[model samples]
Target chain A: MKSFLKLTYMELKLQLREPVALFFTLAFPVMVMVLFGFIFGNEAEELLGGYGQVDLSVPGYIGMVVGTIGMLSIPTTLANYRELGILRRLRATPLGSSPVLWSQVAAQVLMTAAGIILLFIAGLAIFDLRIPNGNLAIVPAILLSAFSFFAVGFVLAGVMPSARTAQAVGMAIFYPMLFLSGAAMPRYIMPDFVQQIAGLLPLTHVVILIEDLWLKGTWNLTSVAVVAVVLILGLVISRFTFRWE
Target chain B: MTQVIEVRNLHKAYDGVTAVDDVSFNVDEGEIFGIIGPNGAGKTTTIESVIGLRKPDGGSVSVLGLDPQTEARKLGNRIGTQLQEAALPERMKVWEALDLYASFYEKTVPWEPLVEQWGLAEKRNTQFGGLSGGQKQRLFISLALLNDPQIVFLDELTTGLDPQARRATWDLIRAIREQGKTVVLITHFMDEVEALADRVAVIDHGRVIALDTPDNLIASLNGETQVLFSVPNGFEAERLEKVSGVTAVHQHNQHITISGNGPLLANVAAALAQHNIAPADLRVQQANLEDVFLALTGRTIRN
Candidate 1:
């Protein structure tokens, strides 16, 4: 436990040192939130379900945070560590592969949470959005969703051959999901066919789950099941095929 | 002598092609063992297997009486490795890396001294990516010795280092051995082995071709000292072969070449004096490990 904590501390410090990771995990989400607020905050029209744009856009930014950290930040960081033999160097010590990989996930998970908080503060200050009912209930849902997305990152960390490939693969998946899942724009603006396709992707589910929790103050039990299944599948695939090269 | 590491008939392959086959070696306590070979000759692969980085197909590897494959975690406390290509987090500070690596061991030496000893005291606050190549190499050597392991493996450790830094690293390695630690040095640089190895294993095609001290390996190749000089116009240069200890003599234009095992230069000088031939452009060349390697493999170590 001591060693794991030490590893986690170092991992978090190292992650914070990376400008690219900082951009994806923290600054990007905050940027998106402020932009969404400025563009659509003051209007009283119903853009997201029944709330104003600022209230609706908060969940989308959270989903974007998860997506950026899971798809772009975590996978690319792991791939770079592997390709550059940072993982191999650790293997020579008492701290083996599992601890190092887990440390990365833990660090990114914390960063995702921090990004969400930043988005929340920015939302409240800029758009005058209020916190929804049942503030404590959001923690479990956020954790499960983060795990579900981190599991997806683990799969990318396993399959991608290089950091460049990981980045390429991450961007390939991230942008489309962001646009289609209503993370980049209001979901009401998306066509019905686009919304159906978005529903099939995991990011859309994350956004909806966060949206429902923040707006309606109730659990979306069906989205929880979907996330649980993905979490298991991602774990299995990554465990079986993860490469140290 | 205590054997710190023992390997028997290790075999490994990748993607249906053999990388290491039938390789075996032992490292005794407190000795610098060098492994030198041409590219793709499986030197790195052999080291990886012995260090438990790979699972061997056919043989057993034991380090400090523990199975490397099964007891790597246990062995990790006793051994250290500096891989051919490795890096820390780019923005990690020097002191942070030293302290972090120090934490991996059950017992650790004070890292403050390591920083001073390695000439990295001022660079402690500098990020890893900001360091020069030599500074990075010094940092790696310091990190490898951080745990004060009983045995250490270093592979291609000084490939890009400057000459002064390379010399410092060699001295640092010797200092490690002076503390009664064992080392396994893998490098393609013959000069590095010649300067540092107590004994070297010459590997080729995944097999140990010769295992002996550097002097013995060069001697076993029948390497000869050569005497080259331009003979006075008409003096018979070939006649120097009759002088004791000269084995082969050849003449190209006015230059006479005399090759022999021992004291050939003295004998040839005497023979020339006897003939009253004034030798000009006098030169003597002794065979080195590079020449021995070329003779043994018929190929250069580097592409």
Candidate 2:
């Protein structure tokens, strides 16, 4: 346990020391949130007709944060570590193997929290958007979604041998989850067939839970259960396929 | 002497090609043992297997009576290693790497003295990528000895070093032995083997072909002497052969090489004097480890 904590702290410190990684994981997400919030302003409601009656900026910013911090960040970091032989070197030491993965997950969690807070601050200050109705429920819902998406990213990184392939794979999953989860385009506006397919994705359940808590002031038990199952499945797949080299 | 490391019929294969095949050897305590072989002779594989980096397909390997695979963490604390192709992060500072590795061991020598002793004190704040080849090699050696381990393993320790650095590293190996730590050195340089190894095992195709002291291996060559000198005008090969201790003489265009058993150079010089043929540039070369390696493996160590 001591070795694990020491090594994990070392890994985190080394990663945070890199300005490039700091920008990508921490600053980039917040920048995207601000950019998208301005672009979608009050004009977004008129473009999508009545369904866009709800200003899509807040939910959209949250979704982008989840996607970037969870899916894109996890796979790229793991793949880069593998390619650079960092993972191989760590495996040779007495450090516990699981801590390396967990440290990455922990960093993502911290970044996601910072991103969410930044997005909220930007939403209120720049877009004049009010806080969501149920602050208590929305927090847990967003956190659960982050956990699920990060797990999926971990599994993707573990299974893919190369960083380029992992990046491509991460995007392939990320964009669709963002677009179909009512995060980019609302589910009510999409074609019925597309909605049915999106419903099967884990992100769809997360978006549903977050939207319920934020806009409706109520938690969706069914959506939360679905997200929980998907999180477990992702964790299992990652554990079985993780390769140090 | 107790054997600190023992391997029995160790076998390892990668992609259907065997890297280490039925190899076995024991390294005794407090002795500097070297594994000398050409490239692709399975020297690294044998060392990695003993260090628990690679698992043998079918054999037993024990370090200090502990199974490396099962007890790697415990055994790792007691052994220090400098891998041939291992490297730390480029952006990591020298002191950071030292501290990080020192954290893995249960006990470690202070990094300050080690930095000064390894000549890395001036580069303490420099990143690993900024170091020269010699400096990097020295840092690797320092990291290996940080734990003050009972056994130290060095793989191809001086592969790219210049002659001066190589000699300095050889002295360090001797110092390690003097400290009563068993050293297992792997290198293809016969000079390094001859200079520092108390005993050496030459591995060819994953099997031990010769194992003995440097002098013993050279002396077992049956007194083969090489005599080379420029043949003077009117020197006859038959006269050189007729000299006592001269087994054969080969003449190659102004140069003569005489091979024989006892006092071959003296006999050749005497015969040349008798024939009034004083050869210029006379030289007698005694057999060394390189000659023994060629005799046994039919190939030079470096080539």
Candidate 3:
């Protein structure tokens, strides 16, 4: 436990020290949210089945927050470590590799949460976007959605031959998911085939889960069920495939 | 002598390509043991097995009396390793790397002193990517020594350094030996092995062709003494080879060269003098590790 803490702290320190990771994970989503708040204005636009634009944007950007941290930051760090032999080098030490991995997970959780918080603060201050009524369900939806995204990243890091390849593959998957799902725009506007393809993406499920919790007052177990499957799939698959060298 | 590491008939292959074949050796405490070889000669594979990085296909390895594969967790804090082509995160600072490495061991040397000892004190705050090649190497050496390890493995630690930087790093390696730490150095560089290794094992094509002190290996090259000078007018090269202990003599351009075992230079000198021919540039070149490799494999180390 002591070693874990030390490693987590160092991992956070190392990651946060880099400007590129900080911008993509935290600042970029917040920047996009600020832009969305201005474009939507004080008037509520009917989108996503009569939900206000602000109502949809908040949940959608929250999906971006989790996706960016997961698909961008997590894979870059892990695959880079593997390419650099950092994982193998650490395995030779008493600390082993669990701390390095858990640290990444912890750092991702912390940073993703921070990005979400920034979105809320920006949302409340700029657009007066209030938290929806089903706040209790929002917590589980966000956590499960975030875990599934991180799991995708872990698997990418494990399977890619090098950090450069991981970054390339991760970004290729991330940008499309961001645009096709509800993260960049309302999924309701995408063509039927595009929407169906989005349905295959975890981000689409995350956005749906969070929006169901935020816009509708009802708890959506179906969305919860899908997100849980994704969560298990991500964690189990990544764990089995993770390689040190 | 305390045998800190022992390997018996270690063998390994990758995709049916043999990397290490029937290799065995022992490392004593406080000795600088070198594994010298050409590329793909299984030097790194052999060391990796000893350090528990790879499982041998056959035979066994024991380090500090514990099996490397099964007992790696126990050995982790005790052995330091600088693996070939391994690296730290690019943005990691020198001091942070040192501190992080130090945190892994239950007992650690003060990282502050190691920074200075490895000439990395000035670059303590510098990111790894910002440092020069030499500085990065020093940082790696510092990290290897951070735990005050009982044994350290350095594989091609100076493969890319300039001659000056290589020499400075060599001194640091000597200092490691002087401090009573067992060192395992793996390299294809002949000079590096000759300069720093107390004893060496020459590996070629996944086998140990020769194992002995550097001096013995070179001496076993049949002296292979090389004497070269401007061939005096009418100085007979064939006559020089006829002298006792002179196996062969050749003439190239304006120089005559003699090569053989035992007192070739002395006899060549006498023959040249008996002919009353004086060559100003006469000098005997000492046989090097490259010759030992050539004599064993009939090819240069670089090939």
Largest DockQ belongs to which candidate? 1
Error of 1 at A16 (Å): 2.4
Better of 2 and 3 by lDDT: 3
Q: What digit string (tens of lDDT, one per residue) describes model 2 on residues A1-245?
A: 55555555666666677676667666765576566555554443534442222345456557667777667777877876777666765665555467667777776777777777776676567666655443687777888888888888888888998878988888888888778877665688799999999888777777778877776778899888998887899899988987766
Off by over 4 Å in 3: A44-52, A133-137, A190-197, A216-218, B229-282
Error of 1 at A15 (Å): 2.6
Error of 3 at B71 (Å): 1.3
DockQ comparison, 2 vs 3, better candidate: 3
Candidate No. with top TM-score: 1
Candidate 1 per-residue lDDT over residues B183-282, each given as its tens digit: 8999989999999999998888888877889999888877789999997577777678688988889988898888898888888888888888889989
lDDT of 1 by residue, A1-245 (tens): 55666777888898887787798789987887777677656455653455677776777888888888888887888898899888877877877776777777788888888898888787777777766674676677778888888888879988999999998999999899999997778777888998888888888888878878878877787777888888899999999878777
Q: Indicate whether candidate 2 or candidate 3 has the larger TM-score.
A: 3
Model 2, B1-303: lDDT tens digits are 999999999999999999988788889999999999999999999998998888899899999999989998888888988877677767778998888778777899999899998899999999888998889988988888888999999999998999998888888888888889999999999889999898999998988888899889988988578788897556567667778887778888788888888888888888888877878789987888888889998888777
lDDT of 3 by residue, B62-116 (tens): 9999898888878877888888878888888888888777877788889999888
For the second chain, the TM-scores of the candidates in order are 0.88, 0.85, 0.88
Native interface contacts kept by each candidate, as a fraction: 0.69, 0.22, 0.56
